[model samples]
Target: MDHWSSLSMGKNVLMERRERADAARNRQAILRAAEELLRRHPPEQVSVERVASAAGVGKGTVFHRFGSRTGLMLELMTERARELEQAVTEGPPPLGPGAGPAERLVAFFAAVAALAARNGNLMAAHEHAMVTRKSAAEQPREANPIYLFWHRHVSELIAERRPDVDAGQIAHMLLGTLHMEPVASQLRAGQYEGLAASFAAIVRGLMGEE
Candidate 1:
C-alpha cells in the first residue's frame, strides 16, 4: 500500500484500541459504583443517575452501555458471580470436577446460596429491575449469561444422575426457586445454610438417593 494509506490505517487501529480501553475502564467504574451504592442503600434508592455521578460518567453512557437498569443489574450480577463460575469450571472437587453428580449438585447449590447471602441487596435489586423490564417488554425474560451457565451446569448434573428424567425442565424448576421473593428474603436474612440444606435434600430426592 501507499505510505499515506498505511499511516491512515495505523491511526484508525490505534484509535480503535484506545476506544476499547476507555470502554473497559468505564464499564469497571460503573460496576464498582453500582455495587457500592447497592451495598449502602436499598434498591429503590440506587438509581442510574446516582451511579453515573459516582462513576463520573454521563447518564446516557450508562444506558448506552447496558441498555437499561435491568441490563446493568444483570451485568453486575455476572461480574459478582465470576469467581463462583471459575470455581465450578476449574477448581477442586465437589464444586468443580471429579465428584459424583449428587455431590457436585449439592456443592453448587451451597455455593450459590452463599453468594446470594453475600449480595442480598444486589440480588434484590436485580430481581426488581427484572420484573420491571419484563412487564414493560411483555416478552420472555432476556437471556442472562450467568443464569445460562448455571442452568447448563445443573442440567448436566441432573442428566448424569437421572438419565430418564427431563434434565432441562428440572434445572429450570430448581433455579426458579432461587428467584422467588421468599427465597431471596431468606438469603438476605442470612439463612443460606438452611436454604442450601433444603436444596440438597430436594436434589437428593430427585436423584433417588437417600
Candidate 2:
C-alpha cells in the first residue's frame, strides 16, 4: 500500500528466500558429511555431533534440521534414492535416455548397487527398525519406496528388451542382489571387485543373452 510498507515487505521476502537457500545449503553439506562418515565408519559410529562437526555446522543446527539421528539417517536414505531417481530420469546416456534397453538395464542395476553400497549401513539400520517394530500391523505392507521404484524401472527395461519374459519376477530377482543388506555383506566380505560387471552379467543373464 504505502511506499515504506511495500519496501519493507519486499525486504522481508528477500530475507526469507536467503534463509531458505542457506538452509538448503546446510542440509546438503550435512548429508555429504554423513555419507563420507558412513563410508569410513559403521552407522553406529556416526552421530549428530560428528556429522555437524564434519559439516562445519553447529550441533544444534543438526538437531534443528533433522530432529534426531534416526531422522537424519532416514532423510539421507531418501535423498540418496531421490538422487538416483533424478539420474535415471534426467541424467546422461545409459542411466537416462538414448541407451538401448539392455544397456540401460545394466547401467540402472550398477547404479542402484553402488547407491546401496554407499548407503548400506544407513539403510540396513532402517530395515532393522522396520522389522523390529512392536506391531507387525504397523509396519509397511508394501515394499520400501526406493526398492519399489527400482523394481519398476527394472521391470520397464526388461519389458522393453524381452517382453516375453516375466519382467516383474525377473526384476525382483535382480533387485534382490542389489538390496542394502546383501550388497553391504558382499562389500564387507571384500568381494567388491568387478561388482558392476557382476551386476551387468546378471542383467544380461536375465535377458537370456549370452
Best by lDDT: 1
lDDT of 2 by residue, 1-210 (tens): 999999999999999999999999999999999888877886666778899999999999998997766667777888878988998999997999889888998888677667766656776655554554445444251365766788888899999989898999988877666455666687544455477888888778867776
Over 4 Å off, model 1: 1-10, 134-142
The global Cα lDDT (0 to 1) of model 1 is 0.90
For model 1, what is the error of residue 32's alpha carbon versus the real structure, in angstroms, after optimal superposition?
0.4
Model 2 scores a C-alpha lDDT of 0.77
Q: How many clashes would you count in candidate 2?
A: 0
The most accurate candidate by TM-score is 1
Estimate the TM-score for candidate 2.
Answer: 0.69
- Candidate 2 residue spans exceeding 4 A from truth: 49-71, 78-87, 90-93, 118-145, 180-182, 188-191
Cα lDDT tens digits for candidate 1, 65-90:
98888888988988889999999999
Lowest-sum lDDT 10-residue window in model 1: 134-143
